[model samples]
Target: MTRTVSDVIAALDAAYPRELAEPWDAVGLVCGDPAEPVERVLVCVDPVTATVDEAVETGAGLIVAHHPLLLRGVHGVGTDTTKGSLVHRMIRSGIALFCAHTNADSADPGVSDALASALGLKVLAPLAPHQVGGTTGIGRIGELAAAEPFGDFVRRVAAALPSTVPGVYGAGDPHRPIRTVAVSGGSGDSYLDAACAAGVDAYVTADLRHHPAGEQLEAGGPALVGVTHWASEWPWCGQAAEVVRAAGNVEVHVSTRCTDPWSLRA
Candidate 1:
């Protein structure tokens, strides 16, 4: 069976509902001929230079990513800049680009949910529960049936995530048992205050900044563990692929390239 770009977009919209995206997010089709037939789709956390090349090499007709290739309006698509070059390449190759961004973040079985599940944590409620009916929000708070030591949870997260950079910063009592957990997929230091308010024993996500991690720990907030931002959210590709596959018969491939743009060798 054949499917149009709009058909695939419709299926994604039915599940994620583009309207659910935060006002500032750039979600939906960034580039593509919607009427073109889609035989293969690449699902990724970020649509960076390498991921785009991967999609083209794989003969993918569409690229579905978590981060928007064009988050803000682009003044030009000239190859002089990185993003412009990518836009030019996708346009020339006839590969569509679609992003699910904040919409995916806020979805019930969204990025954080997938991350939490990876560590066997059960979502008790949202740490920053999204307001229903298109309202914006933050991360989620969950519970582990049997509390695991913070060190144990860290190992579980590191094992579950794809090949990623080990975090340079860490805080809090590593040996303490962690029961209640908070999860936010992307750069989540901004939400430390909220996580603390929720009273979660540990907060796990990626890209923890120095000030927030230091201050939060010193101030006696949730014990924080950092994962690669890309690794943390990559699980959603499978989850989203499952959603898309359930909606239609199509090939959904998860891109293997990290697209993280970082490698911590030490």
Candidate 2:
């Protein structure tokens, strides 16, 4: 039986419930007809031209992105703007777009879970459990498969995530013993307090701005390892693809293309 776009979205919705999403998030289908039969899918962290190009080249019928393409309000999707151009291109190429965003962040086996798996963390619980979803929330608190020096843990993370410019950065003593950790994909500075509260040895996440990080470390918070936002979230693409694949008869491909905005580091 041929599954329509609706089936794919339904599968995604089941795996990453919209109800779990933050109130401000833009989730669900962004474009393409629900009735359109889907033969192939491409899962990615960002919905940029590069990923879209991959979808077009591979003849993928749908692209499931972790980040919302039209996250902010846009009065028009006219071909004049770069974002608009991508929208027009996808439409003309018969490709559909779907965004999971924050909802995927809070799912039981969600974005953070995938990141934890990639980093070999034995997930114990959520860093910030949502009031509604039992044991499902913003980030994951876990322990390493084996305790290693803080420096070794940093090296492990560098090897685990997809390499990109501005490689992983660490805060706190490199000699500090690290066993337990809390991980959240993408920008996770917001969870610094939760990570501290969880009393984990370390916190692994992306996009850790300086001021907050300095303050956290100054105030005797957990060790921090910050990687590229894209690298941090890339693992979820594979997890998401697997969910969709298990749901129906669809050839799902996790895009290896680096959509991380940082091309070079000075």
Candidate 3:
């Protein structure tokens, strides 16, 4: 069955409702006409140049991204600027761009859910429960079937996530036993308190800043597992592709190109 851009969007909204997005977040279609026919969709963590090129090369009619290309307000989108160049490229290539953002994070089978499941954790509940349609929330708290040392768990995390230049790192005692785990897929420092309150053995997340992480550890919180932002969020792309595929008869491709800004770490 042929599906238009709006049809695919409706399917996405059903899974990750835009209403669930934080007020500050920008979610939904960034470009393309509602009536435009869509047969191929590309999913990725970021809609950067590499992913855009992937869409063009693969002849994808639409891009469903976890991060919005234009999160904040923009003055212009003329071909000169970085974001503007992306806009022009998509327009010229007849590819639409849509973002899921916080909405996907808050979905029941959301970003954190994917992360937790990837690490073989059985989900218990949302770390910060949202009183919405379903049991959707920002982060997740789960339990490992068997407890393992912090160091072993860190290796497991590194193994689970897509390998990047700066692999996963951990804080707290390497010998500490960890069973219960709390995870947030992207920039999860804000959820440290939630993870601690849940009394999990470890908190796994991405883009953890030095001060917040150090302070959280000083306060005797859970062991911290810090991963690259892209790795933390990449698992959701496959899950999201499933959602899109269920919506219509379109070919969905999850871009494998790593768009993490940090190339090499000293």
Candidate 4:
């Protein structure tokens, strides 16, 4: 069976509506013709050169990336430049590129939902609800079935995420009891205040910076578990692949390559 790029995109957009995307986001298709027939698709967190290599090697007809490849404007996509080479490569290979990005983050069973589920949290609600809708927002508020020590919760978080160089690090008393928690999948410092507002026992997220982590802790916010950005969002690749594969006429696969840019932790 075969389906057009448009068919696959319709399934994705229906699952993660473009209307739910932030105003500044560049979600949806990045390249490829809608009318082009597609037999296989690859899903990944980043739309970089390495994932592109995986797509080509695996003979993928389309790539459903969680992040946008062209988030910012570019002068041109000449083969000489880095990003341009990727665009050219995809074009020549008859492959299509599409991104879910913030829309996927804000969807009902979105990025944060996947993150929360991986750590065995029972989802309660969105950490920050969307302005115009219910059950759709930036992050999620959830709770474990039973309270555990913050240290144990931290270990659970680390084990749940894909093993990475940075791994997972926690702040706050190891003995502190953790019941409710909040989560956001990628670069989630922006939601630190929101997580606090939700009054979760802890917050699990990626890319926590020095000052923000300190301020949040100093202000008596939730226990913090900082994970690598790539590891945090990596679970969404499998979730997305499942959604696309169920749409039929498409063989979906999640890229196993870790495109997390951080190489050395020490």
Which candidate leads the pack in TM-score? 2
Each prediction's RMSD over C-alphas, in Å, is 2.1, 1.2, 1.4, 1.2
TM-score against native, each model: 0.93, 0.97, 0.97, 0.97
lDDT (tens digit, per residue) of candidate 1 on 1-266:
78888888888887687767889988999999989999888999888888988999999999989999888787888899999899889999999998998888888768888888887888777667665433235577789889988888777777778876654234678788899999898888778888988888999878788887888888888888887788878888988888777657678898878778786676
Model 1 scores worst on lDDT over the 10 consecutive residues at 129-138
- Candidate 4 clashing pairs, residues 3+ apart or interchain: none
For residues 1-266, write the lDDT of model 4, one tens digit per residue: 67899998998998899999988999999999999999999999998999999999999999999999888888899999888999999999999999999999999899989998899999998888986458999888999999999999999998898888878899999999999999999988989999988888999988888898899899999999999899999988888998898789788889889888888966
Candidate 1: RMSD to truth: 2.1
Over 4 Å off in model 2, which ranges?
Answer: none
Task: Report lDDT (Cα) of residue 105, candidate 4.
Answer: 95
- For model 2, residues 1-266, the per-residue Cα lDDT tens digits are 88889999999999999999888889988889999999999999999999999999999999999999988888999999999999999999999999999999999999999999999999899989987447899899999877899999999999999999889988889999999999999899899989998899999998888998999899999999999999999999999999999877899999999988899777
Scored against the true structure, residue 30 in model 2 reaches a CA lDDT of 85
Deviation of model 4 at 70, angstroms: 0.5
Q: What is the C-alpha lDDT of each candidate?
A: 0.83, 0.93, 0.93, 0.91
Instruction: Residues 66-171, candidate 3: write the lDDT tens digits.
Output: 9999999998998889999999999999999999999999988899999998999999999898963447989999999999999999999999999999988999
Model 4 earns a TM-score of 0.97
